[model samples]
Target: MFRFFIIAAEIIILIIVLRSSFVQYLFEDIQNSVSDWLVSVATLPEREELRSLKDKINIRLSPLKPYQQNYVEQITADSASVKRFYHTYCENDDINPNFTGTKRAQLCLIIKQSPVMQVAKRD
Candidate 1:
């Protein structure tokens, strides 16, 4: 019917118009706005007052004098216990690992240990 033909022709024209550069620009602008909103939402809250003194203490021990090493170890042990508490309660291995007193345990908190990194290295 003529009415159907008119409706179909109008829809086709609308589609063609939407495919034009101006409509593409509008679409891209909307996309950029949405992504910017997501970025704002995904950002972590600004760290509270830089960092606490415990976080200031380096977990590494060798370079320090024995007294400093003892102090660092005590602080590290306390922080490690905190890590263990969260790991136990949350039951998320990815959040933190079993914190042994090794250097690797300290580094594990700062680095990505996911198997994906291993795959990337292989390639």
Candidate 2:
């Protein structure tokens, strides 16, 4: 009976710890880190265009200041939308077709992650 009580107490403590805000924050940080890693890996530059694309994306994303995170899920859902936007905004401005496949994929991700980019307009 004593061992049972001890085990029950440990379980209760474990549950409390799991429910704590610190645990929540830890999980959020882990998720963010994983997400960042995925984005970095997917965006790795194989060609020259990708090397400078991040800067260009930041500049484009800047105008949509006071950004919100609510749209990220919706925006990221449709890759075609991102492609159209990239072609319309990024590719047309450039004078060449030097952009690589990886670069284009990364551009789509960058815009999708942007808080202020309109997802509705794409649809």
Candidate 3:
């Protein structure tokens, strides 16, 4: 009975570890996909034109509230900061740079979501 319990405990532990690892992998894959989508959208030529149209529509439909305005400003500031940081550190670097891939993806996500930008358009 003692030996059986020991084996069962070990198997359960192993299963838990494997499940944790799989969950982590899934989360990472989702993040990467979202980051890639955001990067593509941001770089698109039509983005600016669309944004302008959106602004016009919003103006006609409903004015943004103070909270929404603040959110939009924050997002814009965050995006600018991210771009500046990337250009200064990652893009212009001559050395290995040694930045992790995960961090880069995170920065990309921040640029894409732009909480401030979303707030401006909120319903």
Candidate 4:
């Protein structure tokens, strides 16, 4: 019984002393290292966004040339783009029924992440 008490008291005192010593920092370091070793914190990789071509047409009266309109149409034919743009200006079928080709190209330029912008940048 006396030996058990002595051991328990020694353990309590040792813990109290260690809490006051630099060993506490060492223990924290070991804990952090073990935590790092046991599990990696997941994170997404960094990325740069591609800059899209300007929407500003030099022409004052003319619409997009057929090739450019075709390019925009080809790029936007993608399901992802339709899903994206449907929520955007394409949803404005109410507005576009009367507006012309220039207005549609302008909408393509508006969505920065669209593949149309990226493909135009490539071309």
Candidate 5:
């Protein structure tokens, strides 16, 4: 009889604790932490060669502004986009006034010289 009362009291206390804001917040925090950990574990790590290539490119591009760096990255990602954009805009320079022909050519040259692009060509 005494053990039953003790178990019932514990259960009641547990219910009250669960309803508290601190407990709810703690549960949410733990859940988010576990979710993040699982994602990191499931995601494959970056290859060392690619990482090195990216690092080298980053160093070379350190002098460039953020938007210019984006241009270089885009050129490496899809060289065809430049050609399409050129053909689409070259007819009317006012249509796309952002990246001029000379600037695009410079970015292409930098991308061509990057180790990342060279490695990509091998495969």
Candidate 6:
């Protein structure tokens, strides 16, 4: 009986591990597809607004000293306005509407990692 229970537990653990891996792969595939779609859709005029906002923010804030620029970048990158714009326009509405603090932090990280922003800062 104990051996049977141990075997059952091992099988359950294996199933859990496989299920998690599958979920991870599924999510990654969906993300990649959405990213491709977003890039294509971003060529449209409506999406141009987001790009323009980024440009404007970069222009408005780039002239500051390095530390000030970092401060402004951090603030603008994580601001509610940016989050709203991304959620309202960039993301699919079918997903969760609530942008949690972690999601906002991820947005900030993306902004900070953007090569376009880096180039803009240089010029």
Top-scoring candidate (TM-score) = 5
Taking all chains together, each candidate's TM-score versus the true structure is 0.38, 0.39, 0.24, 0.28, 0.44, 0.26
Q: What local lDDT does model 2 show for residue 84?
A: 56
Give Cα distance to truth, residue 72, candidate 4, Å. 24
lDDT of 6 by residue, 39-103 (tens): 77865643454455456545643444565445444444433545554444345333333333555
Off by over 4 Å in 5: 44-53, 56-68, 72-123
* lDDT (0 to 1) per candidate: 0.48, 0.53, 0.52, 0.51, 0.57, 0.55
Better of 2 and 4 by TM-score: 2
Cα RMSD of all models vs. native, in order, equals: 13.2, 12.8, 17.2, 12.6, 7.5, 16.5
- Local accuracy of candidate 5 as per-residue lDDT tens digits, 1-123: 999999999999999999999999999999999999987665423234334534555575456668756654553344344344434544334443445566545434554564544545676
Compute the lDDT for candidate 6.
0.55
Candidate 6 matches the true fold with a TM-score of 0.26
Q: Tell me how many residue pairs clash in candidate 5.
A: 0
Q: What is candidate 2's CA lDDT for residue 57?
A: 61
lDDT tens digits, residue span 19-87, model 2: 999999999999999999988677553222332333456455443323322232223334444455566
Better candidate number, 4 or 5, judged by TM-score: 5
Rank all candidate structures by their TM-score, best first, as comma-separated numbers.
5, 2, 1, 4, 6, 3
Lowest-scoring 10 consecutive residues by lDDT in candidate 6? 92-101
lDDT per residue (tens digit) for residues 39-121 in model 4: 53321110111122222221422465676555445434444454455455465443444334766655544544554445445
Error of 5 at 94 (Å): 19
